[model samples]
Target: MSGEKLSLKDLARKRDLLAPGHRLCAGCGAAIVARLVMKATRGPTIVACATGCLEVATTIFPYTAWRVPWIHSAFENVASTASGIEAGLKALKRAGKLKYDHVDVIAFGGDGATYDIGFQAISGAFERGHDILYVLYDNEAYMNTGIQRSGGTPKYASTTTSPAGKVIPGKLELKKPISHIMVAHRIPYVATASPAYPLDLMRKVRRGLEVEGPAFIHILAPCPRGWRFDPRYTIEMARLAVQTCVFPLWEAENGKYKLTGVSRSIARNPKMKKPVEEYLKRQGRFRHLFTPENRHLVDEIQKIVDEEWNWLLKMCQLS
Candidate 1:
């Protein structure tokens, strides 16, 4: 597969769509994800963001951080809202009332919205073939609502609702395979990315836009407060997730899969893969997994990660 075509030089020339003043935490990976995505877009664009950290932090009252046309949708209807927007644009174009030659319609939602609350909406939109790109900045938990557990949170990761106390060692269920779910939708494009790989992520964003039908990109966005990590390790957490094979970066175009970035390299050489512990130890949410009694849990988690990574590789191989 061809590597990420967009270079740092090309990206450096693009103006930042997201402004500097926002209420997101210091060293927030979601912010980086949004910025890189904005850089990838060149023409007229309209953004529809679900009610989450990005929406709340960036558009507080009269003040706004978004330089492009933006809309704020409810937690469970961003996809529906974007679908309506796309439909409206089509209608206007058919009537010869719209001025723009082309417009990119994108939706931004966090894990709570995308993986759970908004799943049905997204599924419907994709099935209806909306010309929109849906991006999920998965911080693993509902960080905007006091670090609550969500479908996107990995197993054994502690959250306020699923605390790592004496009886419970964090959440028991595995994280939902959302990217795979999107792929199953049979959309024109589906991808998994991380803010750590800006070139890879930006490339996927651009590719998703190029596709005619609905597209989805699931991005790992580390949260310092929610994940219990230092502010400086935001990007490190994103990188470690890919290196550990806990989150493999890949893209599926027209139902054909191909690994990308470090994940592609690691797929070629298994020796390049790091242990899942490297990723777990960095986050406070998984601190309990390192305990004497819970040590076996780490091995178990490693097994699952390995299995998932191999499954992804097989999909690409078969493709």
Candidate 2:
């Protein structure tokens, strides 16, 4: 996994680490993200998954979708469990009981697990500098648990817990800045990715595994059922998220930031980016924000997007 871009042919030849026939929802972005991440691997890897859609759908009573070794840990301990596995492997190798020179340990969690319930464990793992990669499939709300609102839910987006109402619109608070939070840990690698851009996502996963210390990749996985979008438009919504500067694709390595994928151009010329309204209109969760009385909320969301985009550009030294 050098800096060189992998050809589609080369990527196609790789074994499908996540086999088909799973119960994941059709057009589920998390499933796509998992497949691409596993396909990018160059060697054997172990996966630790939090109790989320991925885990439930992939590992039903008597079947599984994973081709490689995988562990389904509790919702709040995916990172810590992966860290322990990494430690055990290190000990085994040191005792000359293991022959392999390297084996990647990756943990996967949804927004509820990563941003709320599992935050402490994930933070501890990063703080301890464990040799593991943690990937957060941020579908905004808790899609698997009746579409409850989580910390990752964007402002004005409707959810089960934060439903739109007369007095209080949708979610009143903004989405958590998890990417910057991870950057604050000063880990070896921290990246933002989307399933719309498979190559970029794969590249980030590959880079994250290549690093020695703890690494993190936050992926914006759109939910068709929760977001109220067409199943076929999952990738389109993911692309719009990046094109509108609502979710930028970038990475921070050793505390230095650099834009990747379509975000590079958006970082250079903000005018090239699409309007946040375009992205909002495509999703039903934010449909309430389009009203004349609530139109100001759209402007507010746009303002926040601009502020965050500018902040990212400044951090990347592009502004």
Candidate 3:
């Protein structure tokens, strides 16, 4: 809650609320993100997951990978459902009918659900000031539904819907600034995290849970299958995303922003930022952008990344 660093043993000692034996793809970043989030909580937690890769894979039929109480809600209503659950719990506590004094409620959704179809519900929950943590396991595209382009998909990344060809190169639209959107709601906590940095992610998760009102974490989860990369490069790709400033790790609390992890260092020294190409070249989804004809698209993507990084630094008052 205080941004205290957790030792490896400390993290290891925490119970794995999200158990193993699920059907997530090999090296799936969403699973890693969920596990880390579950490990960071201090007490009983109820998780509401939207219909996506995480929900479908973890709660298949009778078997479930979740060790804690979990609910599988509709794609566009995870936040709303979690809000209802929070309201119900509060009502029970008010009537002295609840056994537990404290319980953390969390909602898990993919980019398609959080950044696209579910945006309205998410925004409404934040506006209503629900005591819940909404985490977006953003693998960019809608990986669960055949790798379609979603609002979170980065520009110039090819997806099943946004195919690279003679016409449009890739997803021409820029990635939706979901974290900023959440910050605009003036919530207690808003953060962008990557599974590559588990400690930082855990710290943010802990901080979010400690807050009194709504909290949102946007995680840049890399998809090895959809990204067309080797399963082993999931963490590496996530690291590259942060190092390249493509996905800056930062948190906004009550409108005040602070860069974290490698992004904090990069904020102090912009020269330390890695090229966006380093992050893109590894993923096959952006492979076509490297072609001679499509080289401009890569430059365009770089420009957007730089603008966003600079703006983030400005928001944090780092520059």
Candidate 4:
């Protein structure tokens, strides 16, 4: 093994791999996620970004926040574009025409691209067994364009399209379990991480990079303006997400599940999980969830989360 100790903090520096003069809004989670991810990955790592907030905000005209070779693709073509790059890299490596043998390919996309628009392309890459790392920095909604509901949007989280009203209280359906869907792919590695959990997130990123086949890391990123929360509370909101069981940090490799980031009291905490209302109450998006019927709906969602957690505990042997 190399002499490098495994420390995400040691690995990540705040000295602007993405740079300090970027155009991201205050407390932009995508920008933070991008920086952390780039910091974790060493060598000639190339990034392919879709047409989203990060792409537009970072790269305007001749300027860019990225220090590595980065490409801007269409909204739904990041995965496909990354696949092509991977293929070319392989061919070049095979022909002894490539400069670096440690080149890692990464594709970054928002929730809309990963969960809805670019999903097929992502699925195709995985099925084809492309050797690349696809990171979905999920802010839960189509944040690039006004806050609209996407497949990753949690139940009752208000968006512009799924606005709360007298009868309709934001989104009525459950959040799409994209990490579970990646597990269904039976790929080499699959993990769910959050920006708040930077060390854990970087650990998983390193593991995924070491894997031979396709890998997926879904990062739960918080959007301040989109979620109607104060920009300063982004980290707190993310921490609460895992604490409340709204988001679980777990991994599935070679069909075996492993749950991480469990609180001290497993049984008691699972049964007495923090109310979804608490999470919703932080953001104005879910203000309606505080109402009687909507509060009940939020409870129902919590129950579903409990059931899933219990099942995962058995499948993954969580304490």
Better of 2 and 4 by lDDT: 2
* Per-model TM-score versus the true fold: 0.98, 0.98, 0.98, 0.93
Which digits, one per residue and each the tens of the lDDT, describe model 3 over residues 65-162? Answer: 99989998699999999999999999999999989998899999999999899999999999999999999999999899899999998888899999
Q: Which lDDT values do the candidates have, in the order given? A: 0.93, 0.93, 0.92, 0.83
Candidate 4 has a TM-score of 0.93
Model 3 ranges with Cα > 4 A deviation: none
Clashes of each: 0, 0, 0, 0
Native-referenced Cα lDDT, model 4 = 0.83
Candidate 4 per-residue lDDT over residues 1-319, each given as its tens digit? 2213457466744345677688988998888888878777856788999888999999998888888889987999899999999999999999999989768899999999999999999999999999899999999999989999999998878899999988888888888889889878888989888888887787788778888888999988899989999999988888788777778788888768877655324544566467656787899987877777666876787788778777777877632
Whichever of 2 and 4 has more TM-score, that candidate is: 2
Which stretches of candidate 4 lie above 4 Å from their native place?
1-4, 12-15, 263-273
Model 3 TM-score is 0.98
Model 3 weakest lDDT span, ten residues long? 1-10
